[model samples]
Target chain A: MIDVKSLSKHYGTHHAVDGISFSIGEGEIVGFLGPNGAGKTTTLRVLTCFHPATAGSATVAGYDVFTQSEQVRAQIGYLPESVPMYPEMRVREYLHFRGKLRGMTREQRETSLRGVVERCWLGDVVDRPIGQLSKGFRQRVGLADALLHNPPVLILDEPTVGLDPSQIRETRRLIGELAQQHTVLLSSHILPEVEATCQRIIIINRGRIVASGTPEELRERVAGTSGLIVELKAAWTEIEPALRGLSGVTEVRGTPDGSWTRVALRAAGDQREAVAALAAGRGWPLRELRREIATLEDFFVKIVAGAHEAQTVPVE
Target chain B: MRNTTAIMNRELLSLFCSPVAYIVIAGFLLVTGVLAVFTGSFKPGAPATLRMVFEFTPYALAFIVPAIAMRTISEEYRSGTIEALMTAPVSDAQLVLGKFLASLVFYVIMIATTLVYLMLMMVYGAPDLGASLAAYIGLILVGTMFVALGVLASSLTKNQIVAWMIAAVPLLVFVWFSGWISRAAEGWWREVFRIVNISLHLDQFNRGLIDTEGVVFFLCTAAFFLFLAVKVVESRRWR
Candidate 1:
């Protein structure tokens, strides 16, 4: 649904988005992951035709963003980072105006209005002024405005930034539901939100895509191998060597907490059965034993740290 | 064209829904009515006309036009709604023209309220019907030009106060001090200043004369400023 090649946006000496290339297919929910000021929003803006690319080309729904911007704009529903809205207008009034602005006929708008308000859960607040609503409601109102036209592609930047925990979970579920019919390209710095909703993740840093893959793939690639966390009613000195002595255990690090020792260690593979056997055979009170799954947060930290190291190292 | 009309509708709806619009309308009616009575030197048995009101319309609009036009684009730019509007299926020309048309319509409504004064004149004394019609036309023409100027100012900056000053200061100078500037100039300069003077363009229309030159002058000037506004708005992409 969207294709970009060597896209760059420069402001004087600063390259806000520098020669980034990526593509999103139809019915794909792709997460654009990056740190703050990493040019994620800039890339989204360029694709939405809100700003012109300084170099290279991009197309959305088979239309070039710079040359054929009108057609491109008609094909995409955009929710900018700030969630632009008119505070004086009511929710229904705002949606009606947005629908008209997007070139919907009165009849079409009237029909879509009901579906959109229900979809975004804006029924109770539809008659209230936008300025009087809470931040969570306002965010959903922005989402509702985007969904009004039912465009093929939805571009959202930081959709769940300021929502509470429940609101964030709801937004994630909403995005998951939206992925069934629409191509979604959402950007965020929150790693778990991306992990929860996106089919694919593209991590960008310093105006470049550092890594792109599924959550499992990124974990295996950056974290190398998985580990296990074992808590036992034993001292660190005893538990560490015992875990290291197991067949698949390659390394062990342990810390004594109160009356128990928590041992974290890496292994060759499938060390769960072997560790359980070892704990059982040792006759040590096993408080807890679980495999430590590497999360996206860990992968993100490793990728960013590696990128920083690579930048700091000088060529020999 | 449809997009332009939609934008105009949205702008007008937003303007009317605000308390500021009513205040401005009432203020225009009060100021123009008082100025008409005082400047016309109304007294018992004296022939009453809207000549004083027409004479002061240009000056009145110089301040009022900026207040109305200042928020056309500047508010959107400041609030980041311009991003949403520009990203929608609307062109730069459509946005500028839509805003200009909305302001013109609002100003015309304000001018129409002053017709009560004209009715009072008709009941008390005989007024020149043809001259009153000409004055209404002139008021609209000059008001259109000022609206375009105000839009151009709005496009240049995100600050409404700055936009108002950018439009009103130069307009105030042209409406009140152009004659002095025209007199100070010599030979070709004097004629050049007079040709560009707004009051000179208004003189023919106020005197019950509807020449093609006066009509074309205001039309072209309004068009020129609207064109500049389109350019300023389009420049956002480059930035």
Candidate 2:
């Protein structure tokens, strides 16, 4: 339902999205994983027809984002990253306003309003002014606004941002349910959020796609190693050299934190036991020593380390 | 268009829902009431006419209309709601027109409240219905042009205070230029200044005359500003 060909967007000399091309199939939930300012928002803005591409082209639901923007916008429901809303408006009224803007008739809007309110779990705050609601509720209100017109394509920019853990789970479940009928493309900086909801993941960095595959493929190809985060009270200067030579230790990255120091040690597997033992042997006070989860930073490190032939954009 | 009306409806709802609109309207009523009515601009024995209402209302509207329209587009930009709004199926023209018409309607509502003075005049004396009606039409035309200009200013900045200043500048020029028109004696420059002298044009309307020239000026001024506002809004897609 979405096709992008060498899409490039530049703000003056700065290339926000540089010649990145990717397509999403019908009824597919695609995760756009990238760090903040990775051009993810810029890419989605082009697809939503919020901004014209500086180069190349994109089409959403078979309509050109540049030329046939109204048609493209009609087919796609977008939740912008910031989730801008009319604070003074009630949830139902805001959705109704959005529905009207999408050219839905009064009856259509009312029906869709009812459906989105229930689906987005906005029934409690439906009558409250949006500004009065919590950030989580406001995010749901934005989601409900996007869903009110029932567009076939939904482009959500960090849809789960600012929500509590439980709210995040709810949003994920809702997006999963939506994928059965709607072609979903959601962008996020969090590794687990995207992995949880998206069937296929596109990992982008510095305005280019660095990797694309299933979560399982990502785990097998990259993340085959483990790292430990060791934080302890010690002389910052002596921490790295002291821990860099342990068996299976390949990389030691450390930074000073007052008298305490935090270090990330990349090793073959399960390095927490080794790191704890080293701290004990050296007589450095250990505050916290834990294995690193497969964070985005770790994912990038693995991709950069293993895939020299993968044309990876250097981690700047 | 449906899109245009939808935007306009939202704008009107927002205006009515806020206390600021009521405060501005009340301030307008107070100023116009103090200037034209309760203060004896139209004395008891003074001819039964709404000339005083027409005389000062344009200036009252000049300031009041900007305050009404200052938030029309700028608030959307400030709140970042413009992204959601522009991304909708609505066209730029529809959005601008909707906002333009909303401010004009607010102007009408505020200007219309002064009609109570007209009703009072009619009760005590003989006010010409057709002339008073023509004068009110003149007021509406002035408001339409001012609202269009205010919306254009709103499109120029995300700051409502900046928008208010920008909206007031050309209006200030017109008010000051009205004097320049009176000074220049029968020349092309005078005609140039006269074309821009809204007070002179509105004065013709106050006299129960709706010249094609004045009507065309109001419409053309409104159209020019609204067209610029649309261009300003549409420019965002490029940037």
Candidate 3:
């Protein structure tokens, strides 16, 4: 339930977020993937109404951010990149204050505070001072505060940063659960976390949207050729020539690990069988040979690198 | 209005939770009490009364109010809590008013603690109760003006120390140099300097004179600074 149209933010000469447009539907989990200084935080800040866009506009829950900011803010919950919390406040007290700030009555605040504490797994430390908690717990408290008002939209920037592996997994699961009820716009540099948690991904670079699609869609679009890495008891001099002579073999490189060779193959169709037979015919012991499925990480690297190349190339 | 009250409550609660409110009140009472006693034995100079308490308050406020307000907006900016606050369902005016009101309340509490001086005057000598009340009213008005200026200073920077310095410098200049400028000027220039001089306006109140002009002047100054603070915060959102 969020719509951003040609949104841009400039700090004098530095453009933090260029003309970027995207819409998120209700109950959909969208991940904003970008490296540092990639405008993810700027975009989220605009949607949350923390910062007004220098040009263009955004609407949340059918309210204009520039004119109807109060209504927009009332409908969206934002957890900024840095979880800003009062260290002196207890977990429950902080949640209560946040709920009141979001326009909840006393009874409503108590009810929502209970739900947030349980949902974010903040029960054990509800009475503890927030500053005394571990980083993981502090992150959870931040999440709890965002969820305190039960807003229909959530804008979380790097929600899983600095958390241990277990906490990260738990946060991912919580986000997945949240998606069933609330529209989530999550920003993160961790590719796997985005892949595991978001149904759609938007990759941004240098204040521009480079690509947007499902994880598999992006992976397939960027991964044009499939290859196999085979570890075998063979020398590069002996296996390189044979694989080169194959019908679909495009390139092959041997690693210094004398027993392994990575072969890049191009074929009109599935070429797994051709490579398998070639390995079988050579009678060279094949230890491992499997088609490499391109991952989100590979797609991200290729897209960002390609954007960098396009920027550097001179135009006529 | 609900949001403003909520914010005001939170700000007041935060002040009490820390030692800030208590320390400010205690320090103010202790200092003013000592000054009142020390000035009492001055051979009955200038009709010794609670006027000295009001006379020293603006100078005291020149330092204490900044300390109370330096963290109002600066701490939020530094800790990144301003992001969350700005995203709440509150307008810029509401936020500014809420913070100003909270600091004003603290200033009142600090001023209220000096009532011991009034009680002592009642016991030792027949100090003019009407004049004493008028002076107390004047002190509150001047204190409100200082609080508003402090809030403006806090809004200009995220660094609390810098905010404190910014707030204190202007106040010190106005209090100390306004008299100097008044002396340096002739007819109209001197009168204008005296009118603009905060301490000069405050002197009328301490003398048991309820000059409506002085009251309006302090209020207008407070409103002007608070308006500037709101504008500063609004401009920051675009940046």
Candidate 4:
């Protein structure tokens, strides 16, 4: 129920969110994945009508974000990244205040408050002041506030950022449960948080949509390749040239060994068989043969490992 | 209308919760007492009217109203609460008016405490009740405009101290300096300053004169500042 096209937000010389566009369909829980300072929060803010886009357009529930801000805001419930709240207000009072601000009637507010408080597990601390609450409780309070209006759309930014491990799991579970009733668009830098809760992941880097796909699709396309490691008595001279010659072998590196050579090769699919044949044909004594690293974190390390100036960030 | 009331109620709650509200109230009463009662106005031989209290109120409100209103918008901006607040269904006009009215209400409550001075007048002398009522109305109008001006200043910055200064400097100029500068100026310049001087407007009411023209001026001035506040708030998107 949210659509954006060619959106750009610039602050003088720095482009916070350069031209980028994405859409979240109804009942879909999409994860906006990006490292810090990525344009995720900026994009969410534009959708929530907190600010106007420098160029292009955005609509929430078919209401224009810029021109029809109040209507757009009414259709969506947003939890800001900082979880801005009145510190002095009790959790119950604060939620009621938010409900009023959303134009919910007293009856609607009362009914919604009960559901959200229980859903967010804000039962006992409802009467306690927010300032006195811990960070985890504060995050829950922010979540509860977002859910209190019961809008059809929920836009949450880093919903589990400061939570404890258990709280993180609970928030993920809550978002999963919320998907049944509300279309959610949550942004986070953590990979598993996105993978654990989102049906689709949109990876943004340097204000651009570098990748967007389902977790499995992303794993296959972005992290489909595996790394090859071979330990042998061969010299770096023969191993480098021969391994680089193999098909789908994109990168090769060697680490110092005691009168032995250990080489690491990054290649598409698997190159273990090829390397074994090469060692046999070259008449070099082979010690070990295996796929060095080929897990999700290989994707994490490949994309984020900085191992060889990876193609994670495209050269603009 | 409902959104406006919601914001106004929230503003009142926040105002009452902070120490600044009580400080402003106590400060105002202290200043008003020194200026009108303790120094001269309600003495043995002097006139036992609330004329002194009404005359000096605008001066006291010059500082008091800003202290009450500096947090109305600046705190939200500083604490980053403006995101949620502005993104709610509330309009910019509603937020501005709600805050302006909240400050006005707090000022009224503070001024109500001065009614004890009126009761004191009831003890020894025959106070002019009609004039006293007119003065109260006049003060409320002046307070309305002052609160609007303060809200406008608060909207311009996220610093409460800066907001207070921004509202106070012009307020002092409008209330105190205008009358003095008008006395020094010649020709229409003098008349211009005199007509624009807020004290001159309050003077008409101190004598129990409810000038419809002054009433319109106060209301229009208030509306003008509130309009500026709304514009200033809307300008955030450009940043």
> How close is each model in CA RMSD to the real structure?
3.8, 6.1, 3.3, 2.3
Q: Considering only chain A, what is the TM-score of each predicted structure?
A: 0.80, 0.76, 0.85, 0.91
Where does the lowest 10-residue lDDT sum fall in candidate 3 chain A?
Answer: A307-316
Q: Which stretches of candidate 2 lie over 4 Å from their true place?
A: A223-297, A301-316, B37-39, B181-187
Evaluate every candidate with DockQ and list the scores: 0.67, 0.64, 0.77, 0.78
Per-residue lDDT of model 2, residues A198-249, tens digit only:
9999988778888887788776655556778889888767887778777888
* lDDT, candidate 1, A16-72, per-residue tens: 888889899999999999888889999999988998989989999999998898998
Model 2 pairs whose backbones collide:
none
- lDDT for model 4 comes to 0.87
Q: Candidate 2, residues B1-239: lDDT per residue as tens digits?
A: 98898899999999999999999989998888788755474785788887876787777676778888999999999999999998889899999999999999888998889888888887888889888888888889988899999999999999999999899877977865565755764777676777888888888888999877889999999999999999999999888
Q: Per-prediction fnat values?
A: 0.68, 0.92, 0.80, 0.80
Worst 10 residues of 1 chain B by lDDT: B40-49
Q: What value does DockQ give for candidate 4?
A: 0.78
Local accuracy of candidate 3 as per-residue lDDT tens digits, A131-168: 89998898899899888888899999999998999889
Per-residue accuracy of model 4 over A1-316 as CA lDDT, tens digit each = 9898999999888998988988889999999988788789999999998888899898889999988888988888888999988998999999998998887899999998999899899999999999899888998998998888888999999999889999899899999999999999999988888999999988776687777878887776654667777898977887789888999999999985987898888899878888899889999899988885444445644444442444443223
Number of the top candidate by TM-score? 4
Clashing pairs in 4: A301-A305
